[model samples]
Target: MRTKVAIIGAGPSGLLLGQLLHTFGVDNIILERQTPDYVLGRIRAGLLEEGTVSLLDQVGAGARLHQEGLVHHGVELAFGGARHRIDMHAATGKTVTIYGQTEVTLDLMNARKAAGLTSVYSASDVKPHDFDTDHPRVTYVKDGVSHEIACDFIAGCDGFHGVSRASVPASAITSYERVYPFGWLGILSETPPVSPELIYNNHERGFALCTMRSSHRSRYYVQCPLDDHVDQWSDDRFWDELKRRLDQKAADELVTGPSIEKSIAPLRSFVAEPMRFGRMFLAGDASHIVPPTGAKGLNLAASDVHYLSQALREYYDEKSSAGLDGYSARALARVWKAVRFSWWMTSMLHKFPDEGEFAARIQIAELDYLVSSKAASTSLSENYVGLPF
Candidate 1:
């Protein structure tokens, strides 16, 4: 098969890119190693920056999001037994939409199907070949048959552990990473959220986040040892532990329920430099990862797609290679800023194992300053609402 672009993975990045390219009059095919259900089954970040929502609107997939997604103007930071609200909208003139990543994938998937686009799910052994030359193609195995797609360019939207980045020669890519000592033990419950807005708490016990998928379905997380297991945290135990970390007001108002989904995710900050490799380019998790503290994971992917789709459109419409040539540096600039923000939030909100009383006191002081000073609050609010795309 031949196409203008061959995309790897059927996750939000790949699907959104395909939709955007199709809207831009670019022919593209998506290859996925998992089924459609599997892709939508993955629960991910629920926060969407204004820029990300705009991209979805551009692709005509924002109808459901606009109708169902909750918009938050502020976020609360709880520390020292009190909660301080950061007015994100007042400070940045922007707002974030609380919409699950799964819903975004579903909307894009439906849009792709309605447009009769090509997507090969459950394909195995997918690989990109000859990306260093003008001619680049992708190969995969499906239903015990081998296939190859000849395309003008290849897009690696797979993920951090995907074949897209793994295919690259180690010497060609420079990687920087830091794995945190703790992981987040999260649970999804069918209960009303304790607070109308999301609450991020920094307590002597650990870090706990109170977020929701909807008004009735809440998602909560508490920091735990990296080696902790889901079985070790029962529903009652998780609720009890969460309450212990919350302030008196939130603890009193918190509702407990049976957990429908629970898992532990280790925190890490990673980036692979030079997102472009000849005719093939990496976007989204294929190039970088950040701790979820600042809720930048999915938004970063959207920004990468924005830069990439624009580059491809320019290449086709104006026959210009400038955007393509500058894709990596441009995307990395935004990616690094987000990485720094996520790291900073993680550091300020989470209790470190080895960091002694001095470090703890410093964190308290920083949080105190962050809430008391308008400049610091505005900075945090701007970053939280997202920087300009």
Candidate 2:
């Protein structure tokens, strides 16, 4: 098979890249190891910053997004049973939308399908070959038959394990990573959100977040000890712990329902230097990862694809590879910014016995300082709300 670009992984990044190329009158084939249903069903990041929403709109992929998304203007910070609101819109003049990553994937998949595009699924033998040559090839199995896909360029949007990144020479990619001490235990409940706005609570027990998936459903998370067995906790125990951490008052309204879903999300930070390797380029989880604290994983992936598509559109015509040349450095600039923010938030809210009480006090002091000062708050809010593209 042949196309202008052979994209690995049909997740958000790959799908969006195809749509972007189509707009430039460039045709591309997206290959996936998983079926469309599985790709659209993965539970992942749900927040979209202004730039993310704007990109979707420009690509004509925002119809359902704009209609079904919940635009949140602000979020609440709760401590000592007192709630403080950060006016994200008033502070940054922009708002974020709450739409799950799976929803975005589904949206892009449906849109691309309607356009008569087919993304190969259940494909085996998905591996990178001939990437050092002018023509890169993606070998895979489809419909019980082996196949070879060759293209002028390859995009690795297949997450951390995708083949695109593996094609690169090991000496060329510089990687950095840090693993945290705890994870977030999240659950989706049928009850309405306990708070109208999303709430971030730093309670004595741990950190808890209360957000909504929709009007009738809520998404909540609480920090768990690194080795805590989630299967051991009863529903009552979960609620009691959340209440203690957030300092919820008895009089406050609370939602009651069976937890429909539960899972642990390990905290970690990762970035691969020089995101581009010859004719093959890495994007999305294939290149970087940030803890869920900052809601950056999805948007970060979008940024990479956005740059990749623009480069392809320009380079295809003029034979100029300026954008491709600067791909890694340019994307890394933003990636590092998110890296710092995610690490900082994770440190500030999580417990570390090795740090001693003095260190813990300093963390609280930092939060207090941000809340009390515009300069500090702006820095936090800007990153928390979002940075300009």
Task: Summarize candidate 2's per-residue lDDT along 1-389 as a digit string, tens digits.
Answer: 88889889999999988888888878888899998778876778788988888888877788988888889988777765677777877777888898888888888887788887758988877987777789788899888898998789888899997777777788988899998888899888899888767887766677888887777888888899778877967777787777777744521577767898788888899999888887888888999999988888999888888888888888987788998888888888988998899899888877764667787778778778767777776677788766766
State model 1's lDDT.
0.96
TM-score of 2: 0.96
Give the Cα lDDT of each candidate.
0.96, 0.82
Q: Model 1 Cα displacement at 242 (Å)?
A: 0.1
Using all chains and alpha carbons, the TM-scores for the candidates as numbered come to 0.99, 0.96
Task: Tell me model 2's lDDT, rounded to 2 decimals.
Answer: 0.82
